[model samples]
Target: MSTEQTSPAPTLAEDDVDLIETTSDASLERTQRRSDAIEREIGEDPTRFRILTGDRPTGNLHLGHYFGSLLNRVRLQDAGVETWVLVADYQVITDRDGVGPIRERVLSLVADYLAVGIDPQRSTIFTHSAVPALNQLMLPFLSVVTDSELRRNPTVKSELEATGDRAMSGLMLTYPVHQAADILFCKANLVPVGKDQLPHLEQARVIARRFDERYGRAGDGSRPVFPRPEALLSNAPNVLGTDGQKMSKSRGNAIELGMDADTTAKLLKRAVTDADRHITYDPVLRPEVSNLVLLTALASGRRPEDVAAEIGDGGAATLKKAAIEAVNDMLAPVRARRAELAADEGYLLDVLRRGNEHANAVAEATLSEVRQAMHMVY
Candidate 1:
């Protein structure tokens, strides 16, 4: 969802505040214009509007994933925007020392993309590891950014805290640079991101400008190598899991996209709630139950208070049953679609293989220009 919905732009610490405002005047204006154009063309010719978004194949995607990003990706694709979905397998190991079942997760990720309405004909779905050129691009990008700059990234800090790992891997430290490579590889000019990712996107803009100033100019003085990407901030609200924290796989509180009716009900029954006997939509006082209200509203396209009122005079158990029915109703189509897609392993493999070929060709072209710009083409 849009960062705006997530509370005001986070109060940046003095040191970090400047990083957010570091965009050059010219680049800021250019990005603003791009943002405006995207708004104007939402229902018009979106072929020119290129969007890049995807997920890390760490595990199966959950309901939180659907509300937060997967839904927006489909909207953008349906609007005729040129969309590219990346399965970021490379990012899976950045925090942990080792990982398992990556190949399985990648396949599952692709199935979810399809089941969620991401049309491969309209959007390029590819794997990160398939694009070797992205790694090459990351090498040069790392030099342009400093350790202090990387350390200041809020996402990295939060992730470190989440993992409770004192020692940060070199890969974890540099993933932002790698992310820049991903954006620039496809020359993606529009990114759908939440508020927390503002720093990472801003850093990518800095990297793009730095590369352009150093090597993007031709004899004609045109900087065509990369377009600084802009964030299309989502307005969707954050979705909490059954246990009342952020919905995540490791937390074991998430409701995966592939769950059936019985599974959805079981999870909702165990959702956290306060001791109050009455039903109300006081998110501040009863976040656990209100979270269920929010989920029902999102699923039914109604207001939370209205949903709370409809389930009048009931406690957490009443709310749980309502939420279960609403969620299962919403997920019925997605489950059926997922099941159909999962049955065809060969077709899924071909989809990725074809997408990989397309991605490799585009990456090679960008890498060639980058090598030439750096005078490494001898």
Candidate 2:
């Protein structure tokens, strides 16, 4: 396999910061307005709300994955929305890495989903590779998106830079088209994503609109086959790693979802902090310490400033100890659940099989409609 340097993944906080700094005030306001409109729509009808979300099965999920999107997914499922969770194994090769460990990673990802409360009864969880029609959908989607548009995608740019901008495979470049298919396959109208990912969703919308203009309309001039999916932003705070960078599996800074108390403690003890023993929550001046405070706040359900105030004069040792306790307390149940789920390989496979069946049915129905719309059904 060809080698490339992938950029270290950004923490949720970093993603927000980078976007906030770069986005114009008018653009931010526009997004906020759109969000408010979506919020109102969210309350109108639960049955009409269809959400699509998932992770690449490239590695184990960590706390960054937990707070950022996982929790929101569970909430959506419980709230009676038609939720679809995808294991995007097809996307893992965007970095040109071979598929040797993808099978194990896919199973581990399923185990993590179960452990984190993603009920198969509520959400359809399927592997991307299992849905043949989804890949077929990508072929038409690619027609609407131009090469320059793909080149301009921020996520693609970031991934390319991460891999030292080398080994720029065609698969890597067209992954966004595949993603568009993922969202449209289920006719998902709501996409849960970070601010940084809004562009990808925008591209999906563009593709949907183009497809509709060309072949999505009905004979009676009714609704289009696919809805222009909207971005459902999360208010969750970014969870940085011990190094104060984005918590990532590749970076080795992440505390994995299945880590035990002992492992959590060891990791926290070495988390980057200041030389001074004083504890404060000034992220600007003391990012490393502030990162710890933020994690504790999320874990213990306390405010970061309040946690800082409570730990006044306690120094780095006291702060780290508190973080350790809070993180372990938060993850202990998750760890136990993961262990139980992992022990039952047969059960995990069954869940995947069931989800795949459900997803394939939906994707096939949509693809049939697409083919009919384009006069290819015969």
Candidate 3:
């Protein structure tokens, strides 16, 4: 029901006026690059239906997570999508060194999800590993998706170096098929994604079409069994780590979403800053300072320019301290929520189990239709 217009243009708080305009132009060019407005209507349906959004259960969520993708998921769920947040536990191993962290970290990742206000009530929180039949759908879905489609997935190309496994594992090579299962398993109609994930979303839509073409036509067949799940492309930026590198656990630069006060302070104290000392927010000209300022602004719900002004009268040390305080203040209520959840082990488990049950109900509904379409059922 929200009929809000898309904002003027997407820009980082610290983006210069010119850089912001150029970025907008580049976006318009991409839109013109493809001659279709059909794609614009992809995830805009207002039937008040299903959404699937998730994170790789690699590590604890963090500040970067909040402003990056998680915030939008929160918004969507609050806006009444039957939102499902998958704890992609098994997918965490695709590029990782080993499974040692899986057992401990996966649970903690769930805690992070809960702590960050991804309510178990509003959003069903279930693991990728929890649903067996959905994973099984991967092989069959893979049979229909093209090898060219596999290669063209940008995530594949980017992960190639990270995994160091040029010899494609069936698991890594056809991750899109798995993703299609993630969506189609629940008859999901909406998927929130960053720009990097558009190809996979396209493949999901294509796979759904191909399945219908191949299996949906019979003596009485006239309709596709699956709906084309649409992408809710994220408007959030790729949040930088404290070191101004990509915010990742492997990089050892990410500020975790569930850090204790002392640890959070220690991390920010060591965070990178500019040498010139004057406090301003210009990401292109001053990445380090701008990142800190933006983080502070995002966490405090202040505009970047306001943060710039707040720091303008002060020295670099004062700015850093204020930014740190702002971030800490933001983390306070979230941390409190987490602590309350963590203390009540039974309540947390009940939430997870209840959510899993509901999710299974959804999955089973879709699986039944899939079975009927494939003629595997009476």
Best candidate according to TM-score: 2
lDDT of each: 0.82, 0.83, 0.71
For 70-127, candidate 3 gives per-residue lDDT tens digits of 7777766666667888878777666555667675675676777787768786788887
RMSD to the hidden true structure, all candidates:
7.5, 8.1, 9.6
lDDT of 1 by residue, 155-225 (tens): 67776787674788889988888888888898998898765676778878878876665454423446657
Among residues 3 or more apart in sequence or in different chains, the pairs in candidate 3 whose N, CA or C atoms overlap within 3 Å are: 62-257
Question: What's the candidate order when arranged by decreasing TM-score?
Answer: 2, 1, 3
Cα lDDT of candidate 3 equals 0.71
> What is candidate 2's lDDT per residue for 234-288, written digit by digit as tens?
7888888999998988888899998778888898899999897778898889999
Q: CA shift at 94, candidate 2, in angstroms?
A: 1.4
The predicted structure with the larger lDDT, 2 or 3, is: 2
Off by over 4 Å in 1: 1-18, 22-37, 159-166, 218-220
TM-score, model 1 to reference: 0.89
TM-score of each: 0.89, 0.91, 0.84
Whole-model alpha-carbon lDDT for candidate 1: 0.82
Worst lDDT run of 10 residues, candidate 3, spans 14-23
Model 3: lDDT of residue 139? 61
